[model samples]
Target: MKDTVVEVKSLDQEWARLILEAKKIGLTKEEIRAFLVSTKEL
Candidate 1:
């Protein structure tokens, strides 16, 4: 519904902000992806 769409959009923004912050600290895309994939197994 409308609420779900709004929540997803908010999450997208938060994720974008986190990724930007990670990049600022010199984290590479492959490292980020590997970390995320590892978390999925937990």
Candidate 2:
């Protein structure tokens, strides 16, 4: 799988959407952070 990098100037609406989605699925902050770091490693 290829990785896509997204650059955002601020954590506003886009970040809120992502956080909301994660929360809706019951993902903890640590889980989200670990998932992000793991994806970076890939």
Residue-wise lDDT of candidate 2 within 1-42, one digit each (tens)?
A: 999766665646676788789989999999888876786777
- Candidate 1: TM-score? 0.67
Estimate TM-scores for all models: 0.67, 0.51
Task: State each model's CA lDDT, in order.
Answer: 0.83, 0.80
User: Candidate 2, 13: how far from true, in Å?
Assistant: 6.9
For model 1, how does the per-residue alpha-carbon lDDT over 1-42 read when each residue is reduced to its tens digit?
354335878888997898888889999999878876887899
Question: Which number leads on lDDT?
Answer: 1
Q: How does residue 5 of candidate 2 score in lDDT?
A: 68
The residue pairs found clashing in candidate 1 are none
- Model 2 lowest lDDT segment of ten: 6-15
Candidate 1 residue spans exceeding 4 A from truth = 1-6
Error of 2 at 27 (Å): 0.5
